[model samples]
Target: MRTAGGVAGAVLVLAGGLLWDIPGLEPAGERMLGIFLAAIILWASEAIPLVATSMGILLAEVLLISSDGLFDVADDVGAVPAADYLAALASPVVVLFIGGFMIAAGATKFDVGRVLSSAILRPLGGRPRPTLLGVMAVTATLGMFMSNTATTATMFAIMLPAITALEDARSRTAMALAIPVAASVGGMMTPVGTPPNAIAIGILADQGIRVTFLDWVLLSLPVAVLLILVAWAFLAWRYLDTSSPLALDADARLDTSRPAVTFYAIAGLAILGWLTEPLHGLSSSTVSLAAVVALLALRVMDGEDVKRLDWPVLWLVAGGIALGRGVGDTGLDSWLIGAVPWGGIPAALVLLAVAAISWGVSNFVSSTAAANLLVPMSIGISISVANSTAEVAVVMALACSLGMCLPVSTPPNAIAHATGLVPTRDMVRIGLLVGGLGVLLLSVAAPLLWSWLGLT
Candidate 1:
């Protein structure tokens, strides 16, 4: 099977090389087509993880893109060579992700998660509605500081006692599902909020586009407000407790450390670093690295804790950036968009298409994988549509980060659905409703944000 696959790849590469003679298609166009076909085979056969296929596409692109100029190497089809494939996966932005992951790992392992968690989840909830609101608020805060999974986990733990006190199991289950959805939506408020945002920003940085942390929060605020309100309404409409629980006033929380000075210190510094990066000329990567060092120096975290970070996810994000870059290099992204007539349509139509594409793709694939692919494609489309990368990428990031549309969409949603408070039908019904509204909100709100920020 390996031999056959390799032979097939070789043949496809040859066919791609010969594509210059076929009609008006250029070599890059043909190569991208071959890459697309290879990607399909990998996805359908599950022969390799979807991310690996994305990396493979990157590998092919790096080797084939002619830095020597297209016409310079016109006659020599094999002039691009194969060894450039290895370097295709390496990029400054990908390295930055690794460093960021390591820092997050060290901080989390040092029990500093507790430090971060308490700071973000302050102003605790007193009742079901309040608990839901508090969870949304905390989810948004923590998501800006950490990964979506980490933020959801912390918020879930923080709200557990208050929610369980409601006494009814159904309310408990609904609140759990609500937690991840809010976190996912809130995450769009910052680039570090999700991998897709980080990668998208990296891509745009290369294209002379920059959006600061404050810029992100300001831009995404409207959509966040809409999502939060919709989330509350959806939960209330479907499962709100009209009557107070028997133990509404009683606390369900377990004993935990109260807020720490270290937690406050770290929070302040992290925010300052992120906020001041634009003026101070410190990249977010440097700012985050500095925060990690502070945690270690202050004895807030230790060496062993850093090892707890998910190394695979780091690689996965790198693969995502590589894929986005490959699409850029191969001109595949350009070809795909040009083939589609993006420029002639209204910008709103383009955003709506991205939101819908994200929604449908995430239902069956890894949300991270979907984000990695769709975001760059969106950015590529933006060039034609008079849309900015930030405009398109932010909406896709929100949709990708959320993935609360089905049990298969994300792990937290799955856990909540499995608890039985949410039947499959219940999940589908609410999930579809929330997902649809969220998409529309992102599509409409992103451009408004750009205008409000004077980005246009």
Candidate 2:
């Protein structure tokens, strides 16, 4: 199946570039179209590793559309320098995620999550309902800083013994469902929280629209908090018995070694830097780099820890940035905008449509891939309609994170499903409810909030 998909993707790339005669599209646009189509096929089908697809995009752009191209092309195509493509690997958005990854790596190495979870859960006591809420809150908080998949995995490892001790199957299923749902929602709260958010930020940055780290948290944190509460309420009422006394081990001791203390200081300062960007006047990317340097220089994290970071996710984000730039530079965005009669549609409907499409497609493919394919178009449509590009970007990014209907919808969901505690039906039922609520909030309530705050 993978081989067939790769061959098909190659054929589409050739056809799009050489055979398809799209009127009004420049030669550069044709080449970009080929790369875009091939990217969609390869990314959606997983015919190759996602990082490979990303690297391929960079290579294709440099070879086919850059001024450094091997083949001659019309002067009207206006190819950019090869350095433009190569720069995606080190883009600010990628750098921000790199900082987040370093923090996560150090935390994992020193067992910070275990200590934090234990500390937080101790206050909530061992009653089943409150315990579930505490578990979810801790998971979501961790998800904001770490990858959702990693957060879910870590929380489950801590909670598994308690979960298995539950006498009721419904209670076990609810506990299983809560971690991934909260993690997915929590990932939308910060720029470095997930790949789709990074993709959105990077694409918007290319358009000269700056979304600060604090600005992102302001816009998304409320929605994330509300969604977590909604999921918790549903799970608590439907599956948990409030009166039941659940026993959880909240006794894990914090590591107080010199290295662990140094890591804690560095990680805490990094987060403080991100949250106080306005006061400090340093960009989040710069703060991220500072954190990275601190970790290595202080010897809290080493070269081996750096190697353990999620390089593939960074590459995937870089590819999306390059693809967005290609779309705009080659005028493919204009062609696509013109292909649809978007001007006649209301701005609200357009936003809703894009959000809906993002949520739906993300359930079937990787959310990062879906964001890569859609964010450029969303930005173009928002521009055509004289709407806020930032709003559209945020909506699309959050929508991508909202998909959790199937095990394949997200890595966190897949990790939860693999535990054999959550039935498929149980997952689908709660997934739809939570995902639907998220979409409605993003499409309706979020816009009103943004407008009221004069953010748009």
Candidate 3:
């Protein structure tokens, strides 16, 4: 049945490609063949890992686009404001956590993972569930410096104690559920915290509109804080943990030889530069990469950690941004907006739909992929409705931050789940309730902010 479905889908794609005149096909229907092949590859991608899927996308582009049209396709597809386009490929700007990760690496340079684990375990020495909030706080704070995944992995090494300290299977299950979900929610605070926000921000900037770092912080932080509060409340009511809060003093003060303090200092300086980028004339990407370089110079981390970075996450980001650029460059985004004509749909309704789609897909897929796909579509829809790219882009950024509805929705939650803290059923219960509330907040908070900013 799957194979049959794949074949039918391939035929439809081929027919459509032939109708559209995509590059690289001779008059004898070669375009349709290539289109059919791409469609199959996209379908097959579902069965493979995502980085493989992305590499497939890159390979497909290489095969289907002619040498002559390759440059043209890129030029047409990649033309959103140059700066905005570049932001898609930039490192995350989580100021504190980047410093924290470096400090962590140094503190455990001889056996960093184990050393970091020992520290986290010692500090979070008591009750398991409460640490979920602690994790979120840490991730969100770190998210202010790096990407959500980075925050999750880094925090995971630190949270070893809390995960181990929790009660039996049921409690352990609950903790696992909360951690990754919290990390997902934590990314809401800054543009650099997640791909969706960065993508939307860049797209709008390309259209000659821009939001400053402070502006983004001002707009996003309130929503993040509120969501954090709400998520914690939901966890408490659901888990009903009867134990005292866990302890971690033995680990927190570990006497490691690594220059954790110095790493922190460099990270702090890097952030000061990022936040003041407009003044410094430095891009967020430049600042983050420079700080990463600084971390290496101090011998805080080795070459191995660099190789472990999630390339799929990076590629997913690059591909999505590339598509957004493509659409913007060809005026395809505008053209599609005209064709769909969201002008007839009320803004409230459109916003509601966008939230639903984003939240629903985030439950299982990587929120980055969902956000990359959804945000641009929402922007196109928004432009159709309001005829303003900035408004649509901003709302899309907010909507992307709403992927708190499931354990699989975000990285922190996944890390938490790995510890076997809570039941899957409980996670769904809490996530649905809290994530639903988050959706509601975005619905109300977004428009209110828009009106206040005079953007609506």
Highest lDDT: give the candidate number.
Answer: 2
Evaluate residue 432 in candidate 2 and report its C-alpha lDDT on the 0 to 100 scale. Answer: 87
**In model 3, where is the ten-residue run with the lowest total lDDT?**
24-33
Per-residue accuracy of model 2 over 96-154 as CA lDDT, tens digit each: 99999999888888887888889988988888888889889889888999999899999
Q: Could you give candidate 3's per-residue lDDT for residues 351-447 as a string of tens digits? A: 7666766777666666666655556565568656673556556665666656555556666666555655655567677677766776666666666
Clashing pairs in 1: 106-306, 161-252
| Residues 1-456, model 1: lDDT tens digits | 854675476557545654645334456556655655565455434467655666666555554554443333455342343344344345444544544554455444444545444544443424456656655776766666567777666655555665666666667666766777777776667766666666666666656777666666677667777777787778866776746532323223332333335645665777787777767887766666676677667776667656676555556566666556556655667767777877688989888888888877766666777776677786678788887777787778667765566777766666566555566666676668777877887788657767776864
lDDT head-to-head 2 vs 3, winner: 2
- Name model 3 segments beyond 4 Å from true: 1-15, 19-45, 55-67, 70-132, 153-174, 243-250, 254-259, 404-414, 450-456
Model 2 segments more than 4 A misplaced: none
Candidate 2, poorest ten consecutive residues by summed lDDT: 70-79
Query: What's the true lDDT of residue 449 in model 3?
Result: 77
lDDT of each: 0.63, 0.88, 0.56
Candidate 1 residue runs with Cα over 4 Å from true position: 1-23, 40-47, 62-125, 157-166, 246-264, 296-302
Sorted by lDDT (best first), the order is 2, 1, 3
